[model samples]
Target: MRCFMLHIACLCIASSLCAIGDDIDEAMRKSVPPQLKFLRVYGGDDESMPPIALTSRPTNLRRPNIPFNFSHVTIELDIQSPTPPQMFVVFSHCNADWSEHDNSFLNDPALLRTSSIDWRIAPPASVWYSYTGTLKIPNEHVKFNFGGNWKAKFYLYDDPQIPIAIAHFFVVDPRVETRLEVSGDFYSPRNTVYSSGAYTIDANVRSVDGMNDGQLNTAVFYRLNRYEEPFIVSDISSYEDVNQRTHAYPLQTMLAGFGMTGRRFRIERIPAENEYRVLNLADYSLFPRSNAPLRMLTPDLWRNGSFFEKSDGGFMNTRFIATGDRDYIQLEFLLNTQLIQAEREVFVSGSFNNWKPDPSWLMKWDEETKLYRLRQWVPRGRHSYLYMTGEVDADNRKAIRLTSEEFEGNTARAGHTFIGLIYYREFGMGGFDSIVGVAGGSVYGSW
Candidate 1:
């Protein structure tokens, strides 16, 4: 009945999500993760951490803010034992229906693979063993049926009667900043919109492993393209002494594509020779459209605006703009839903403010503009912002859903990813915003 119980739980989550509205946003905000969400896990039978356990045995690593459909993931776990032990990990999503095209594969039932991890034999209960493994998750999506929801499970089968351990896994919602589409509006501490300004763009170049964050040898490579070719910004945003996460680069030097949303800049460990070797990613923006709902995919930079010390010192500018068209800038989303607003000081910071989310730098209300704003003129340059919502998912039970694949006749399959390139180009003004009009939304649950 474990499988049935889990299935029931997912269904309840799906139903709760569909019923949510502005009238209930307050009640739902506390229990659910913002945006769409999902959940799953694996480990020993400890059950302390539903999705994980504290054991030397192989376990799956947990990640947040992955796009719904196109977010491809391959989780690997290493195991060493005198005898091999049974294992399983749950990969689930939520929706009214969880069937694939042929109805043979369970859409969000569980993640299954023949070759996931190999285990070394261990002594029965007497010997303790462990294995090291990794999960390779790509920004890819899969769905069997034309339109439906299904979670999956990946595990080691010990026997038909019982199993070793299962890691609980689930899909989750992405935050506003984590949204792959639509750049938010830039705001200052005074709650003002700085549509025009010499902005600062901080270039943070590093591997996911953080191994080569070494003193970035004197030069920093920057490529900026407003949805087109990458322009190499060499010998810019350098520091007298190299720092860890980011290196500040000024935008005044940028020839074009400033203040545009699709503008993408990659900070590479390698400095360019002539200019960037730009590759076409269909639309060629920093973030890929393959993952819907969460558009505007500028990696590494925080959604809230960043802050720095001003040369003048009178006003501390916590917000900035892209310095070109005014489309790409720091935007803030205040959760003043009369629910979670009073308890928190929603602020911004991250790769934006060197990882500092300062309350002092938080935006204030602009009585004149009738909007919250954070504006100051420290130094005009292109810099990243860390948009802070200061709010958690309404409930951990809700999941963030993304359009993973295109089905036959718009009928989706089990693990098919749609080429969103064509669909994205046709988006009208406030391109990503138009997504709200979509009638069909994927239901999901969060951890």
Candidate 2:
């Protein structure tokens, strides 16, 4: 009898500990303030352009390029604190894969950080966010000496060690002429049936005066608006392979040919996902200022194999919003699966989150309502998003590989902007990866 009572007492203690753990998790989630929401980097003149900088004037005027000036890679964010938050920006020169460069010549640690940020209070009617912050790099405090992938980390002035937010951008000192071509005659190796309408991208790099053909053996591609995710194709097979534990396909390289002048890299079996679903919050009548959470008027339905609407190529537009109307709204998203349950985790990804499938954006399955629901705070703008289904990468908790076809569908007619970057393994300053060439083109257009 005493043993039985002890067992019951032990179970009660375990239950209490589990309850405490649950409460702690909930508290941590609640502690994530909206101050770090919607951190974005774009061109100074045009927010639609990618966050890429060109250090030199283009010699070939006809080729498509990342047109933004080196000083115009602007970082914009919103802070919801009562008073302005003391924020600082630190710039890190990164390798082709975004790892920080250790060389002092490439990454000058002393001159790459700043505590200056332009802050403005929100309009009187703005309730969700209190302040807006903007910072343009290559400014007075910081400058870029090397051309490569870059990351701008935002940190609180008090807590300088840990970054609260990070934004990816590019600085290019173009040395080669790159041409990009997109073809639709490709299929995924792992999932051929679902990816029957995949696209193939070929990046042809022509060596210029300063380029070394042997070192230029790698190319990375991005679906313009989804800059955070890169499709890397390298001469080294191991560099192209994905993490074995992740739900991602091995590097989809069709060819990587070396030539006397330059190199040609081809990445095939790229899923041509359907056009993005747009969420317009600029219309005051449709999305009026509300003290309570605003729910999507209509629940999102799954588009298994159908797409009709034209999209903005995943660009977020805030030009139509009034000055006073620019504020964050508590938006509720409801995805009605029509009683069909998802086999993997479902997440809503968009330009708002840099197209990343963050666990915070995960949808909860409602058995009673037979719907997937998520409530999030979003800014007032015209945004594009998609419903994604995939598992969180076990190796990298911050990364996830999602398939749009499982919920959004795939189509050959869907237009996408592709950016191809040529990487050269520069041997100067103990070796660093440099982007020597850049090309941009649309799936339905010429390079």
Candidate 3:
């Protein structure tokens, strides 16, 4: 009788544990927002670019305003509920490395947070999302007084402490002159074929206000349309380097040179990867609106050393569809790997996800078909993407070091834009790092 009673007790405990697990799963599901996107609008174009802007100021006699030079970004997202929830956006100023600034001069919380997002019902055909919300920065509700890396945190009005989504953008108040140069001369640790395509980038920054050279000791380089990750170079040494993994040079001594009011930052052996592959979904006749997921007409074949098809650097084009007609479609991507085998896990990176290789985009290898397949719901547009192979970093699971060179060949002729941002340490207002200049150049032409 005692044994039977103990067995009943074990069953009871098991049932309680299962109930707890269900509750936890439901909570996690509710915590995640359906979809959130931070987009920079260039005039009437809806294509994606780095969400960067110059600090706004009134026109003056000395510097007359230029036509079509306005810079601001919009935050768009979908809320799952039919009734719009009370959402708020809070802004914070960040250092060059993206760490939040603690000083009030750099970040004033009271003036930086707002709950004035415009919400509207999703299109009639949209099924996954119910309502859409949009908020533009530097609007009447909030303004960016300081320039640097900025973070926008979205939160529910009731639960102000926790953020449901976060977006990053940059505000630059150009106070220095900057120049960037790219050349096809560099050395790589890889073999001859890989080394042949390596390029070197040199960014020269000179202070216009006669600032000390030591104050202009930091700078960062980014490939256009790939703003989430940057190669940061700084002279400051700390016990723990925050950007050790993404540093342009392994050591500070590798910096090109320093002058009275000028600093040069150089990064060599950067692979000139071939132009991105294009996935055009703008033709409504070819890709009609449908309830079922649509598969590509042809499977993507593995390209090792071959290159074809010209493409936009890494931008998404959504201007073809009208504002009311814009919608998301479920896309099935298949990569044929019958000719070669993958040594590491494969993922699809594209402008849709800001070229981020998140685990959700991981392609599953099908043994029966010898293909890597991934089904994702992407907005209707033309997107540029690449197939990458890499593992997640052990130290930081969120940081993945994926490369496309193994599948996508590299060539110097492939035009790519490199943007350089000059960082200066301002000793005023308790001292904070700020972007004083911005410049960009392309290997084949001007960006």
Q: Against the hidden reference, what TM-scores do the models get?
A: 0.23, 0.86, 0.83
lDDT of 2 by residue, 327-361 (tens): 87789999987787777889998877778867888
lDDT of 1 at 303: 15
Tens digits of lDDT, candidate 3, 1-447 = 999999999999999999999999888866765445323222212345556766665212232222213367766666675367778888888878777768888678788989888888867897666677777777787877556788889888777788877877777766766777877754342344332465677777776656676678677777787876676667765411644554222323235555675778876666676678898889887788875899988889876545678777787787677867667788999998755666677889887777766777888988888778999877778888988776766664543656666667676777678877777777887887777777778776433
**Candidates 2 and 3: which is better by TM-score?**
2
What is the Cα-based TM-score of model 1? Answer: 0.23
TM-score, structure 3 vs. true = 0.83
C-alpha lDDT of residue 152 in model 2: 87
On lDDT, the stronger of 1 and 3 is 3
Instruction: Tell me how far candidate 3 lies from the true structure as C-alpha RMSD in angstroms.
Output: 7.8
Candidate 2: global Cα-lDDT? Answer: 0.76
Off by over 4 Å in 1: 1-73, 76-85, 89-115, 118-130, 135-190, 193-387, 397-447
Off by over 4 Å in 2: 1-34, 56-71, 125-127, 186-195, 236-238, 242-247, 394-399
Error of 1 at 169 (Å): 12
> Which 10 consecutive residues of model 3 have the lowest summed lDDT?
59-68
lDDT of each: 0.25, 0.76, 0.70
Number of the top-ranking candidate, with TM-score as the measure:
2
